[model samples]
Target: MTFSHDGLRDSLTMLAAPPYFYENLRRELATAERNRSRFTLIRFQLFPRDEQASLASEESQYELAILSFAEVLKTSVRAEDLCARLGRFEFTVILKAPSAVAESLTSRVVTSWSSHQEWSKTALCKSAIVTAKIGESSLEILNRLDNQELIGITQS
Candidate 1:
C-alpha cells in the first residue's frame, strides 16, 4: 500500500514523499510503455553494515546520512530525473536513460557516497538498479523492490 503526505514534505531528504513517488512511477510506467523505451528505477537503502547499528542515536545518524546521500543523488542525475523518498530509509530514482546509462549513474552515485567521509562513518548504503519492463505497473515494481527482488530486468 501507498501513503499520502498531503502538505507535508519529506523533511530530511527534501525529495518528493511516498504518494507523489507512486504518482510519478505511474506516469513513467505509462510513458515507457507507450514509447517502448527503456528506463531505470533504482532503490537505495541505508543500513548499518557495522557497529553503528548498535548506537542508540542510529536513527538520527541515518537521517543525516540520508540527507547527505540525497545531495549526492541530486548532483548525480539530470534535472529532469525524479528522486523520491519512498520510505524512511528507502529512496527511489527514476532515470530516463537506457540500461547502460542507468547502471553507470547508479555506480557513480554509489562511488560518491562511499567516498564521503560522513556516510562512510555512519552506515552502509545498499542500492539495487533495475529496468522498467513493458506493461509493468508502478505498484508491482515498488512491491518487488520492497521485497528485495528485482522487478523488471535486473541491471545491477
Candidate 2:
C-alpha cells in the first residue's frame, strides 16, 4: 500500500505508523486464517507514574524515556517481527510465533525496559498479548487485545 513518508512511520520512534501497521496486520490475519497458523500481537503502553509532576515539568525527559523504551522494544524482538507506534505513548509488536514463545519475548521486553535507569523512573510500562484466532479480522483481534486488562510492569 502507498503511504506518505510521515504516514508510514512514527517520526520519534522510527517505527511503523498506524496505517502501515494495520495494513500489515490485515495481511497477517489473512495468512494465518488461510494457513491455520498462529501469531501473537502484543500491545504496549507507557504512562507517566506521576502525570503532573513528571509530564508537566519533565516533558523532554518523558520524551526521552519513550525513545529509550522504543529502543528496548526494537532490540528485544526478532528482526522479522513488526513493531509499530500506535499513539504518542502506545506501541505494538506482531510476532509470528506461538503464544508461549510470545509470552517469553514479552517478559524479556518488560524486564529490559524496567531495568533501564531512566525509562523506568520516567514511565510505567504495560502490555497485553493476544494470539490471532481463526476467522478473526485484524480489527476484531486488535479490539480484543485492547479490551483486555493490560499487565503493568514497574521497576523494582
Clashing pairs in 1: none
RMSD of each: 4.9, 3.5
Give me the displacement of residue 90 in model 1, in angstroms: 0.9
Taking the tens digit of each residue's C-alpha lDDT, what string does model 2 give over 38-112?
999998888777757645366678778778988998898888899998877788999999989888988898899
- Predictions in order: lDDT: 0.74, 0.85
- C-alpha lDDT of residue 40 in model 2: 93
Task: Find the candidate with the highest TM-score and give its number.
Answer: 2
For each candidate in turn, the TM-score is 0.82, 0.91
**Model 2, C-alpha of 25: deviation from truth (Å):** 0.2
Candidate 2 C-alpha RMSD relative to the actual structure = 3.5
lDDT of 1 by residue, 34-93 (tens): 999878888877766576354235567666677788898889989888888777667788
TM-score of 1: 0.82
